[model samples]
Target: MLISLMGYSMSINLILILKAILILVLGYFAVKIVSSILENGAKKSKIPELVSEFVIKLFSAILYVFVILLAVGVFGVETGPIILGLSASLGLILGFGLQDTLTNLTSGLWIAVMKPLDKDETVQIGGITGKIVEVGIMATKLLTPDNVVITIPNKLVWGSPITNYTRMDLRRVDVAVGVSYGENLDNALSKALELISEHPKVLKDPAPAVVVTGLGESSVDLQLRAWTKTGDYWGVKGDLTKGIYEKYGKEGIEIPFPQMDIHVHKY
Candidate 1:
């Protein structure tokens, strides 16, 4: 009788093992089928690539967990207590060790959703200026004009002030030109205004304005303010400076230089 009982226990264990293996195999194919369906649906719906990728990954993780649970069930194992214990342990560890990571990830999600800056938008954040290349889950990548790559933490980006240079379709170019104290301020101002007006990239709606900003030590400070398309900003700025120099020279507008008089007394 004892031998018969031992034989029955062994048989039951073997059956359980086979059941577990069969469940795992079935789960594998189920997961594959679900993933394929998701991909097809996403493609038909014309979902954004990033959104589709995220959805697929999320579903895959869910399917993996389900497969594990099914395998455990096949062996007559209780999973409720195990799941509770795991959740508690994971929460405690993540709370302590991954606080900053979670913060960055949340902030990055917010930025992606809000889209404060788009790809290729020029932005200045955390004292670094560059064109946005990619915005990831924990950080943002930038490509500087000099071809340098900069990665900034999402927490810092969300916490600090961001200056988006290309936010507006048009921007104002602020240029300062100085002339001799005794020169005709009117003529200098008119000539500077003319130079700005003649630039093809400069906007005409707002109209360029020249004003006396202040009196410097050796020259009369004049500010030339003009509106230009954001795309043409750099070219217009550079050309405007050269144009100012040449035009002022032709108009006999003297650009004063800093000078100091030294006095020496011999006793």
Candidate 2:
């Protein structure tokens, strides 16, 4: 009779093991199928790739946790106490040790949702300027102009001010030009405007303007302001400065240098 009871117990244990294996296999396939469907839907919609990927990972993690719990239950294990114990342990550890990580995670979520800077946007955050490549759960990836990849933590990104250079379609290029005090201010202004108008990237609608911003000790400072598309900002700015110099030289407009007149009185 004792031998028969041991045989029965062994048979039940074997059945439970098989059931757990089957459940895990089925759970994996179910998770895959659901993930595929969601990904397909996301692709078809206007959702961003970053957001879609995050959603899939989050759902898959939850499903995996469920599968683990199911497998534990098959062996007649008390999952409630196990879960509670794990939760308490993790909570204590995470609360004390992972505060910064949790802050970064929360900030990343906010950034993903708010989208202050989108993918490929040129931004200067925390004194680092680069084009945004990926916004992840912990950090954001940037490709700098020098071809270096930079990773910035989400906590710092959220805490600092972000300057999105490409946020607006139009950007203003400010150029400063100085001329001799006796030089023709009106002629200099007209020549500057004419040169700015020649640039293809400079917008014609707003109309470029030249203003005498300051009267310096050596020369009069004139600020040339022009509007151009954000993409053409740097090129237009560089070209505009060069063009101004060339045109001024041709028109005999003197770009004055800083000079001070010193008088010495013999004691």
**lDDT tens per residue, model 2, 237-267:** 8998898889999999999887678999999
How high is each candidate's TM-score?
0.74, 0.80
Among these predictions, the greatest TM-score belongs to: 2
Candidate models: Cα lDDT each: 0.82, 0.87
TM-score of 1: 0.74
* Model 1 C-alpha lDDT per residue in residues 1-267, reported as the tens digit of each score: 112331232224767778888888988898988889988998888565445544576578778887888787664456787788778987998889988888887887678656687688999998899999987777889999999999998899889899999989999888888999899888888889888888888888888888999999989998888898999888888888888889999988999877788999999
Assess candidate 2 and give its TM-score to the true structure: 0.80
**Candidate 2: count of backbone clashes, pairs at least 3 residues apart or interchain:** 0
lDDT of 1: 0.82
Q: After superposition, how far is residue 32 of candidate 2 from its true place, in Å?
A: 4.4
Candidate 2: where is the Cα deviation over 4 Å?
1-32, 45-52, 67-78, 259-267
